[model samples]
Target: MRQGINPSKTDNRIQLESTHRVILSVYIPNLEEEYFKHAEKVFKLCLESVLYTSHDKTRISIIINGCCKEVEQLIYSYKEDYPLIDQVFYTKENLGKINAIYSIVKSNLEPLVTISDSDVLFLKDWQDETYAVFENFPEAGMVSPVPSSKGYLYSTGSTLYYGLFKGKIRFRDVQDPEGMDNFQKSVGSKLYDPIHLQKYLVISNPKNREAVIGCGHFVGTFRKEVFEKSPTKVCEFRVQGGSEEAYLDDPNDRSGFLRLATLGNFAYHMGNTPAPWMWDKLADLKSFEKSNLQTYSIPSAKPLSKLAVLVGKFLWVNLFYRFRRQFFGFLGMKEKY
Candidate 1:
């Protein structure tokens, strides 16, 4: 005779079962010297975030997109300091972002996966919150922190729409007038006040099953099964030659957002940027809020490098192009590094 299992007890056990696995794939190309500081900051955050949430460090996998001697050295040094980092994978040739991510699908990781840019810093609660979203809504393909209108302005796509006007809500009209203004003030700034009330327009109504299109990669998580089954190639950013721009060409154009939409997957953005004690701007916000508690902390990047960044940002909005060129050059794409 078989013993009957209590229904409530069974339910609790089911919930506690660790059926899902999460791999945090960070695309840090060793080639870009300018973003080294930013990369360091991102690494710090990733490490702490995992340490805070994960009871077993072996579950987390760190994928360094393009590898070089210097990049390897950095990873080695970090490993020496923090032993929790389980696996570090690197490629000899610099594969574009989409390609690098696709490479991980080949590895047969757990059912859940997360791809993040090196710029993202994580607090302890970040992973828990992200995982909660996945556990609660199994259909959700990805979730990201809602872009805060605080220090760094929130933007969408190549257009970079900032705000809306009362009379005319045209895209061109929405501009953050006061330079370097926080997102809070930027929302109120006459040029683009409307976005503040809308909260960056990054997420969809959780109550309603609407398809959320795009989100910044600062912090994003997803299910692994969705990626393994995805026929559409993770297209590389061609103009920029990164992952966001990459997509499937023939049958579908399902990039990150579209792919999730196709599979009835949803996403959410946390809306916390320049987080406390991480950057000068974020630190000021923490002080302003009168919150002394160190809820969480992550690494931070200095604004931009002195040389090409200025020329890229100021010269003619060629920051992307200039940076891409510099990155490829450094990666030995142009010549041997």
Candidate 2:
């Protein structure tokens, strides 16, 4: 009982206008508890910051994972208001953060994709600064706007191995100590060592544009091709444990792509509570003029051979990783903080 031609058969293929896609997985079950009292407000701030600062061609996909009806309605309202919010998926069942991300990323066609936590407050120029890192480092697969002093400890084996022999890596004075301190305060923990806050490892190209080696998982922009190497199976954890390391971190490292961060801090990790300062920051963002969006192509990278990756993990990452600080010191990196 179908129509003769369906009219759809002769239609042209659909084309997406965006070059970059931002994916956010939000899970707010309720507002009754003290821990989640201000969750709605914080989510609103996060979404607004992203909308205000992102490039014109960028698209945002919000996955409402097991949130209350109230939260889902709020997200729907935003979608109706903003054209940039291109996709919205709601699930009554709670899917793990990485699992939710994997669902969207598997079908994503954009050259660049940014996976961000729900509470991150993206600042102005975060997208541009992150893209600049990719432009500077052709081998970089992931770039975070918020730099971590202990970034070098994560999945940065490729950065270390390749940059070391090329003499393109060095220890640089930390550019934003106050920003680092703010991150530590947000998490309510002493995450960075005293020495780490002063100096960190950086990789520079011949053009002298430098980026920090390694990055955290809270928020990061990734090249789409790296996902081709990701595991086909969905993650098991509902949230953070080993899920991120297995799905997000390992794929980029195993693919032999460098993980990096901007030299300057362009975002903040606003935990559950929305402080007065966060409100002030959002107010400031409202007044800032939006920049013209420009698009650039990221070059394709070759994945490492299985044997090469295995040997690297065994020899350098597992065995020599602990001694990196001393080794770098021996190679003219000043140990004095």
Which numbered prediction scores highest in lDDT against the true structure? 2
Would you list the C-alpha lDDT of every candidate in the order shown? 0.38, 0.85
Candidate 2 steric clashes: 0
Minimum summed lDDT over a 10-residue window in model 2 is located at 301-310
Please report the candidate that would top TM-score against the real structure: 2
Model 2, global lDDT: 0.85
- List model 1 lDDT by residue over 63-91, tens digit each: 66655566567766766665455566776
Clashing pairs in 2: none
* Cα RMSD, model 1: 16.0
Model 2, 16-70: lDDT tens per residue? 7898999999999999988889999999999999998887889999999999989
Error of 2 at 3 (Å): 1.0
